[model samples]
Target: MAAFTTGEAVALDLPIARVPTRATAFILDLVVQIGLALVLGLIATLMIALMGADSAWIDVAVTTVIVGTLVGYPVVCETLMRGRTVGKLVLGLRVVRTDGGPIDFRHALTRGLTGAIVDFWMLGGFGAIAVITSMCSPNARRVGDVLAGTVVIYGQKQLPAPALAVPPPWLANWVVQLDLSGIPEDLALAMRQYETRFRTLTPAAQVGLGQSLVITVCTRLGVAPPGNFPAMQIIGAVIAERQRRALTPPYSNPELLGLTPAALAAVRG
Candidate 1:
């Protein structure tokens, strides 16, 4: 179920799975929808009879349409109920980004809208073709995803840190721009591993992990790291920048290591 990068053998490194087929998986999706809609319809009918109410069948008719079902059902269910739709639950499925991140309300709405279109005209007409497109894609993105700048991935969610070896003392000194001479060995070792772990990840993954590292380091060191440079590079340059900052006439403010003064000011401010 998992693959690796040929170069690094790093995990979470492969392109994510292709989104499930719109035709096949979505066929199941529609069947679940119909069964659900009928169940709701039966309930509505019973409620109406119990109240002896018939003010507007138009509301009933409108709700019955594919559009209403797609948007209304999941919106109410997931928004109010934490990502579980009646249809999705029955199918043993949940919607999420390919990376297994939570889909925001906007994205949930997009999925519903696309599903409605797919349902209305031969189960999404052109959109259904995107399902086939997804299979060919290494990352499993469908037409809706392609258009919307998203992807669909499967399996249990993963947090985004790559396991890493300890970093060199030089690198840690560069990132913190502190002598670190007085810090105890064990504490320094722990900090070095933390920074190295983020560095080992791909650029996109690094940012997510690095932001936490940046905040923690800045709070401890009294300055932010330079934002302009890649986190790895900044860590590498930290010691040199600190040495320069220390020599300034007035003993300059402890700006972030590895960033230009202007860049450091921008990020800190």
Candidate 2:
């Protein structure tokens, strides 16, 4: 099973698409692309003939159309379709980030541009470099995947999400102001685990671990403890706030308020 860890520190076991499957998908996509190019070429040829254009111009237009179609097809499909091309949709494969997030235009553009070179253009369009690279890489990453920081995986949904911690209504305003960047990933994971299973812990055990976690996180965020709030509440608030920040894009309408992001989220919450 391939373990795909998300940016939120959640790990999912997904099937990695192997070379054979990838090759099949690519061949399917190639056939469609070639068909599109041919149709476009036919149209161009008809137009050129009707206009009595020179042979040199016709040659240039055909070459330009084929090249543009080859490159633009993947870019448009992957970007607009969220990594699913006609071939990938048929094969149930999708290109995602290494972290399992949805890829944007930049990733699609990089993959398409590089794929045209290492995967198709060089060595008589045999994809020798891509095949060798896929064989060598554990994730079957070709030149485009490597450069774009993406992986092609089985596109079906994985395991259900875990229950997340909720911030208390009262402390939401105060907790949002903390700088959470210093909190380590493992520590954050531990906090999530603690939040999920806290009900099972004995009262004494809960107090001890909860206090310790609150102290550690508070120290990391460079904030003093809220006197009246429970330790678990503090921990939960930070985790929830961090999650909200992740979902909130920078320079969004939330920023229009004079309030900081954490504070704005607190207000929204």
Candidate 3:
């Protein structure tokens, strides 16, 4: 259960979703990065050659470049290599503070090198640690995230709608038909409960809750839950309440359209 680090690596209340970047894709991201690095290295070499320093000074310059690469190479590599850097991109991830913040160079470098102890040495040992810890911790942090203060998220660039599954058969039927008037009031209540359980929680937590709700909601609603369904569907059913409740009088509580996220969070508190 990780918190969302909106832009920087601060503690987040929400967890960014994970897109599995397994061995094959990870290798691909690496190959792409290495290719980029080679181009950069060549440019560095060319600049040095064009300078045309004296033979003695040339040696010093080259030596300086080598040392600079030692410190700077990883920094460059980490950022360019993995969408964000080595440790993050490798795991199909990126770094952010628990407070919903973007990670800076210092944090990225620290996490990249320090996390190497796990990610590099045992070859996937660090990857394994990151995956497991993300599952175990409240903020879904990896070793580097814990030490450097960051969060590993999947899509740093896009903010997708949060989705949940439709547990009850009627709910599922309502989703596809776009007709909610026929649904019973009981199922509506079920949908509301279903939304609360999955939507507010982190993806890591939702993973399990999602599985359970699929079964429970189906049994009660006299329908089979979809195996491996998206979370958005559940939200859709709840959202369908707008259409379902349209039949009711407009004597209306503007709040009846649905629960605002703030209200939901308040209730969660």
Candidate 4:
């Protein structure tokens, strides 16, 4: 199990995919790649025979078949499938950012390139390097994962998401005024985790962790932490406001939505 802190400061324990499972997935994918190569190769052969193609055309066809199956396959699958190649999909595994976010095309491309060039094919001794690297790494990450800032995990078994933070009525105006752009996704995740799990912690932990998070968040926003309010409330307000901004359409006015200063004052009173 590997622990990842969310933007809300919650620690999430996720099961890492070890070599055994990864190897099985790789074998499954390899079989598919080989099958695809054979089919394409046969098609190329038929085309050559029927069309009386020259040596140059044959060379082009052969190169296309090899590159398409070996490199293009995983890149396309992972990018389109959101990090699950055929083998990973079958095994309920997925590749995700180290921060537990979904990977984009850039991440998939890097991993695919690195896997073909270093981890499995050209310099890997047919996966010996990958196996050795995974064994030595705490999270079972191979060279591709390290280069791409990703990890493989049992996606089907992740913990249920925590309840979302609701913005505090009294702080709605204040939260809306603060700059939240500087806060990173991981930090935001940590704050959300802290908000949801606030009640679960002991009194001491509540004070310690909440205060620490408040300081970190305030620093990120280049603002001062509110001294009068409880730390949990501040964290919740920040998270809720962030969420509201994300969901609300651009050009929407908070005051028009009944988030007026008068309403905030009434809630505070």
The most accurate candidate by lDDT is 4
TM-score of each: 0.45, 0.65, 0.36, 0.68
lDDT of 2 by residue, 46-70 (tens): 8898989998988888777867787
Is candidate 2 or 4 superior in lDDT?
A: 4
What C-alpha root-mean-square deviation, in Å, does candidate 3 show against the real structure? Answer: 17.2
| lDDT digits (tens) for residues 32-146 of candidate 4 | 9999999999999999999998999999999999888888899999988878999999999998777665677888889888888899999999999999999999999999999
| Candidate 3 lDDT trough over 10 residues, lowest sum | 3-12
Better of 1 and 2 by TM-score: 2
lDDT of 3 by residue, 246-266 (tens): 323553332222223443344
lDDT of 1 by residue, 41-127 (tens): 777777777877776864764466545556676566655543456544554444554433345567667756665565234465645
Question: What RMSD does model 2 have?
Answer: 8.1
Each model's lDDT comes to: 0.49, 0.78, 0.50, 0.81
The lDDT ranking, best first, is 4, 2, 3, 1
Ranking of models by TM-score: 4, 2, 1, 3
Model 4 local distance difference test score: 0.81
Kindly report which residue stretches of model 4 are placed more than 4 angstroms away from their true locations once superposed: 40-63, 174-182, 190-235, 245-269
